[model samples]
Target: MILRQFLHREPVAASYLFGCGGNASAAVVDPVGDIAPYMEAARATGMRILYVIDTHIHADHISAGRALAEASGADYVLFEDAEADFPFRRVKDGEVLELGNVTATVIHTPGHTPEHLSLLVTDHTRSTEPWFVLTGHTLMVGDLGRTELASSAEDGARALFASAQRLKQLPDHIEVLPGAYSGSVCGRSLSGKPTSTIGFERRFNKAFRIEDEEQFVA
Candidate 1:
């Protein structure tokens, strides 16, 4: 399996490309506003771009999902609960998107936004261990997404707590690839690195350290 992460130097946002093999099928997660790099990469690898998805309607940058989908004849997808007028497929919780041999399972995690969703990628060819999780704004490296962007602090905090709780139930060995890194304002605090493991973050992340909902909200 191949997973490529594209980092935006100015904003420190991460875009992702995941696939199985060269000249195979691929999917893009949280594509930036520019569509050239994604197209080029897919072309060079001789892969077909089947899906272009966003975790949410980004408040920080304009998304290139529509453009990429149009250019590649791929389906543009977003969380089903999203409040957008854009033409795209609505991905529901537990929904699985297949890209040749790779499968990405959607996990509805609303907190950063009412429609926020994360992906659990699995390469059917490999063992059952999840390849990685594509976390848009729900979970970050060292901290969690802020609670005041899409809703009031209290409301967002409550939702975030539940969402985080759901994620905490997962096996600690899973890999997590968050969207924003250092420069983005989405999360309270984040690592500069693009990738992290659930076990490592659970041990080091401040959000994960909070056991009680009241303490977590505080």
Candidate 2:
């Protein structure tokens, strides 16, 4: 499996390009403006862009999803429960998308939005075990996403807590690749550093440390 991250410095959003190079197939996640970088990466790697997904409908910056999909002839994917106006391949909870030696399992970990999904990715060539998670806005380095973007703060927080539990169930060694970092409005205390692991966040994240639902909600 091969993966590359495109970190946007302006708004602190990070997009990903990943898949099995041997299969000549790849996927893009949480893309931002100027898709040239993604196209260039695909060309350089000799991989076809097969999937384009967003963790949720973004509010901070314009998304380049549809444009990239149209240009590449790839499937634009979203959660089955998302309320959207355009057409997309709706993915269900626990659905696994296989591309050669890489497998991406979609986990519907809603919190930042009602339809948010985090990807549990495994590079089969390395190990059958999951190696990392692309946690869109659900879990970050120093914090989790703000819970009031698409629903009431109370309701969103409640949902977020429940969703975070699912991620914690994964092995502690899985690295976390978040969608946004510091300077973005999506999360209050996001880290400037781009990535982290599950074990680190589970032990230190304020939201993750709070076991009580009421405390999490408040």
Candidate 3:
């Protein structure tokens, strides 16, 4: 399996490109800016870009997901519940996209947005167990994504807490790759670090410690 993370500075966004090297097929997640970088990454690995996805409707920067898919002739994917004006491949909760030795399983995690999703990735050859999670604004390095963009902050916070519970069910070793880190308005108190492990966040992240639903909302 081949995996690469593209980190940005201006918007504090992150994107990913991963797939099975043996299969020469790859996928991109939460793409920002132009599609050239993604194209170059896939070309470098001699892989075809098969899928391009967004975790949710971004409230900050403009997304290049659809454009990238179009350029690469790849399938554009989104959660089934997402409301979009354009055509896309809608993946339901628990839907798995198999890419040879690697697989991405969609986990609907609504909070920042009603149709938000997080991907649980697994490398089948090494272990059927999940390898990492592409959290996309649902869970950041140090804090959780703000819910007030699309809905009331209270309602969004409540949904976020519920979403956190779902993430908590994963193994502690799973790596967390979030969309926005520090320097972004999406999350308050976000760490400048590029990534985190579920165990670390669960142990130290203030938001994850709040288990009470009402308190979490507040």
Candidate 4:
């Protein structure tokens, strides 16, 4: 399988593309407003764009998911709980998406929003452990994504607490590839590095240091 990451320099955002060998098929996660780069990447790899998935309805920047789907004949997907004015398929929790030899498992990890979801990708031909988790706004490198993007800050904060705890409980070996980076307002804090291991964050991240459920959630 092949993995590619795109960093939007202006917004300091990150988008990921993952697919199988020969680049005959691919999937895009959290694409930016400009669909050109995504198209170009798929073209270069000789892959047909299979799915254009969004974690949530972004408040930071307009989503080009719908546009890209229309242009490439790919499936446009979002959380089943999120309501949108556009035409797209609702991806439910536990739903598995197939892209050639690659597979992405949908995880309903809400808190940043009521409908937020993360992708757990595994390349069956490569390994059993997840290739990497595409954490939209749920988990970041240093700090977790802010909970107040869509609802009340206090409520968002409460949900965030629970969400972070869930993430902390995952196996230490899982690799994380989060959405936004240092410059984005979507998260409270982000690491200088774009990606990190779950073990590294579990040990060094401030949010992961809490031991008690109440304290951790608080």
Q: Estimate each model's TM-score.
A: 0.96, 0.98, 0.98, 0.93
* Model 4 C-alpha lDDT versus the unseen true structure: 0.82
* Candidate 4 lDDT, 22-59, residue by residue in tens: 64888888888689999998888788888999988887
Stretches of candidate 2 exceeding 4 Å from the true structure: none
Off by over 4 Å in 3: none
lDDT, candidate 1, 89-204, per-residue tens? 99899999987678899999988988999999988788766777888888889988987878998888889889888888778889999988887888768888878888888899
Give the true-structure RMSD of model 2. 0.7
Relative to the true structure, how large is the alpha-carbon lDDT of every model? 0.86, 0.92, 0.92, 0.82
Q: Quick one: RMSD of model 3?
A: 0.8
Give the count of colliding residue pairs in each prediction.
Answer: 0, 0, 0, 0
Candidate 3 lDDT by residue in tens digits, 1-218: 89989998766699999999999889999999978999999999989999999999898888899999999999999999888999999999999998889999999999999899999999999998999999999999999999988888888888889999999998899999999888988888999897999999999999986788988887
Better of 1 and 3 by TM-score: 3
| Model 1 regions more than 4 Å off | none
For model 2 the TM-score comes to: 0.98
Residue 170, candidate 1: C-alpha displacement in angstroms: 1.8
Q: Between candidates 3 and 4, which one is better according to lDDT? A: 3
